[model samples]
Target: MSFLFNSYPLARAALFSMDAEKAHDLTLSALQKAYDCSLTRGLLAAHPQLPCTLMGLSLRNPVGLAAGLDKNGAHIDALGNLGFGFVEVGTVTPKAQPGNPRPRMFRLPRAQCLINRMGFNNHGLDAFIANVRKSQWRSQGGILGLNIGKNAATPIDNAVDDYLLGLEGVYAHADYITVNISSPNTANLRNLQGRDALSALLSPLQEKRKMLEDQYGRRVPLAIKIAPDLTTEEIDVIANLLPQHGIDGVIATNTTLARDAVQGLPYANEAGGLSGPPVHALSLAVISRLREQLGAGYPIIGVGGIATGRQAQEKIAAGANAVQLYTGLIYQGPALVQQCVNALR
Candidate 1:
């Protein structure tokens, strides 16, 4: 692995220097091509006996690949082999979109961070489910979670309809569904975090979940993905409101807007959400606070700036049932996954 990455550092540098969104497209295409071959898949598979369970779904390990990396489920088979306990695909919308304009993603390698306002650009629900359906790789005992959201044009007042549209399409394929109400890119979308709005958003979704249970002959858990930029008051509100809506779990942190850690770097002031080392402290703080309010047994998926076994252990100690990595993978490569899993064990 060292030899492989070392030789390509210059190539990787050139890719990073290009347009961020376009580079992502090229990277995904390359991965898909590599994974289409049997040899690469075999190389990426995890060892046996690495299983962990959360929210009724058994995972191959506790470490997972967070959302935004595979926006449309196009590379599930390829990525599944990299040994993630779980892989979350999409922040899929009720309708397809082109997302925000060019240069919407930026890399802060010095800080091991990424800032993106890709605006949930993805193929619509049908295409998303179709891609997921085509993937041949399922975790040996691992789980798959689908993160759902509203279309960029969907009015905040009617966000429930958009979420319900996604739930209808993805419920059958996912081990669990995440309600993404925290992304800072959409106009006023975070307003759904308010009391009445959150209730309006979740109440109908829970009803749809019940219907899905009846149709599928089983229950599927539902979780909410939050931002790391909230205040103590906002966190308290979520802890109080979650149980009321039968929320199955919480994904504590998507990305952050703060620049404290990435200050003085190029692209540091980019208009998007940042995720990486800069976010480590804030994300951990949110997890700790949530644990304090929600108490024991509230399932939390800790994500943000986790790159080492010690970092993963810290999140677990802070009350995360499972942990996820995005930026860390960008900085450390696939081997980081196994390293952290081994360390946790």
Candidate 2:
């Protein structure tokens, strides 16, 4: 069998022919069917194990699937079979939402880029936890990170409540929980990154985490996802505050609002977050700056525009403890996982 069950070039050609979001849904559905029929992990290429630890969590490899790929955790077993060391899912909100209008996701094959304004459209928390319960991925021992975000209708000031609710629901199930305050699709969501705002948010969250740790008997690490569009002073402020508030780690970036790298390209002017090759340098810049401020031993998961093993190595070279892929996987295929682990090891 080939690395990805079928040659990815063929699969990509087929998928790329359809509307971006529809193709996304079709792919996941087919994978779920493949998994249900017991094709399971064997249907996908097996990545070599490159053991490492991150924020006290042991991973078989450091290459992981970034969030927004499987928003509801419905395809965990199928995706987990593809050989990611960890699979992070969702940006799921408290209520089911339809997200932004049609054509929300766009591809820029020219630069291997994607622009999306997907506004956290996901099944509600209850349904999400149910999907988590149904997943067989955890039995295989790879780590799982559950990414959570606030609903669009929720007032900005009240966002902490939504995050708190997310923590309460996913805390017991997650190997680590990612607090998403960085997605540009949601209104004023990025405002949560401000000094006073971050302080306010983390204080309650860390306090709640302490309570949950005592209750669940496991202390799931908490990571805040930030945007690549931050200022130097803003980055420094967050770096200092993380340790102070007991935030365990930081996912160096979500996506970029700047289209500097994709100017004049179709969808380059789309009103959404830009991800892929264009965001690679921006993500690396944030990761490097974060490392300089956070110093060694602080966990950072570098992601954005990593389409090759060399770029994956570059993230580590820039001080990332591990790396993740979203747009890269869309364009480069599952083979990128093993390639990255092989390179990292």
Candidate 3:
């Protein structure tokens, strides 16, 4: 384990020093190279024992590489080889496009957090599926969920089309599919989470799910990814609606707009959602609330602010069936993944 860090620490630090977006691109390229060289797969096998199951999908473990890390399916094989039990790719849209402008992503090292308004940038559904098809990654005997979203140009009223389009494209390839309605970077996207709007958005999708199952001869679990910024009432409303819509699960809490954890730090006032340590408390609260409303039987994916085993354990204790990490990986490096799996054991 120390050998991996000793061999790659300098490179990782250099990558992290660049602009976060650039660093992300560089990391993707590096992973692709690692996959081709067969280094990443070996690393995954050599790392920790991270094998677990959720939502009827058998994962090598519960610790997963979260969405937004590989916005497109470009590095699916590469990242899958990096010791994650699962790798969720994309906050994909129906159309391929570059997301928000330069300097859109900021790093808060002091607080071990990140602030980004990355606007669901990806190669779109077509490119996303094509990339996934081209990849040799198969979740190392686990699950690979595709996280889908709407286009930035798509209005809240017509957002259903965008999400549905994504679902149609990736449903066959995904072990499960996540409906991303929580990103604060997209204008008015979160409005769809309201009771009436959620019903409108989800009812039709449920109808389509039935049709898809009939047509495809299989059931694809649909999970909703929501924000941590919602009120208790809003959480209750969503919990009440889940079973009604046949929603399979919930990914509790996307990035937050809160700045309390990174308070007074440079870039603390950036205009994107904040992630990492700052979001941990709120995310756990939202998870607990949803758990309370939905009962213990429902599945929830706990995200936000997880940088350590203890933090991951807190999410599980708070009622999350699984935990994901992005900002934590940024701060602690790949060794964090091993630590999390070992701690869980």
Candidate 4:
């Protein structure tokens, strides 16, 4: 293991002593400093080049830093230095807003889980795009997916407009764009997953993508991020709808609202989507069903509860063409990315 990985427990212990959200902020700042000093780059092991294609884009490896880890794209270069084959940022909205009230993030170390209701808090599209353009990640052949969501104040019925706006804003800059309809923290966001509502949503986004592709002379692929708390029928509806709507890929899960895996653990009763080790099986089950329904050769990026190289491999086995991680990075450090890439190789 790299020194960062072996020494991560002490660093994590220090960070875990603070409020979870504050620790997250401080961690990003620290990474920014580390990037400037060109320090943490050496902390990563040799990232085995395990190239794979996802949604018409080539990736250096199948392991990616999931959205939300660098929601504004500010820390992207720093994170990319940690050896992720790709990095997806955002859930950024068309406009910025202070998300829910304070104390929205809770950690349950006993269960190695997190419950957060951070509600798409971000610096909006312009700032997000500027951050993206500042990065050399794509120039280095690193894949980037820009994740988008609606404004917190947007009405659920009129959500399609926000998504269309998001598509237009991010299309030119992204290797792929993720239509995030799955975050449980967003009010009624998951409702967009309904059969007719999803059709209504994807229709306009697809139409807009056609126009944008014509104008930009490039077709940026779009993927939908789904929630893990779905019934089998709901999963089937999404699987059928995405391909029909011209969406090129699917991100198997976001976070889970179900707390069965963490019952009796502290913060288990928190009101928000739950993630981490507890989500692994639920996420795997969703991936399996999505693969069966979407059929072979379709791109599926599995995420949730992956903290080890073996867990990452398990996701690939469950039908994910590639895999992403967020909470795992928090608990296991950046070395997990190298482990996953090596495992996939």
- Taking every candidate in turn, the Cα RMSD to the unseen true structure, in Å, is 1.8, 1.2, 1.6, 1.3
- When 3 and 4 are scored with TM-score, the better candidate is 4
lDDT of 2 by residue, 237-337 (tens): 99999999999999978989998888899878999999998788988999999999999999999999899999999999999999999998888788888
TM-score on alpha carbons, each prediction: 0.95, 0.98, 0.96, 0.97
71-173 per-residue lDDT for model 4 (tens digits): 8889888888887888899989999888889899999888788899999999999999999999988998888899999998999998988998899998888
What value of lDDT does candidate 4 attain over all alpha carbons?
0.89
lDDT of all predictions: 0.85, 0.91, 0.85, 0.89
Output the worst ten-in-a-row residue range by lDDT, candidate 4.
Answer: 38-47
Candidate 2: where is the Cα deviation over 4 Å?
Answer: 1-6, 39-41
Can you write out model 3's per-residue Cα lDDT over 1-345, one digit (the tens) per residue? 366644556776797779988997887787677667755446544345666667877777788888999888888876766677778989999998789888899988778788999888888888899888887666346478899999999888899998788888888888889999999999999998999999998998888888888988899899999999999999999999988999999998899988777779999999999998879999999999999999988989899988889988899999998888888887877777777777787
Give each model's clash number: 0, 0, 6, 0
lDDT of 1: 0.85
Record all residue pairs in model 1 with backbone atoms less than 3 Å apart, i.e. clashing. none
Q: Is candidate 3 or 4 superior in lDDT?
A: 4
Displacement of residue 92 (Cα, Å) in model 1 is: 0.4
Query: Top model by lDDT, which number?
Result: 2
lDDT, candidate 3, equals 0.85
How far in Å is the alpha carbon of 5 misplaced in model 1? 6.5
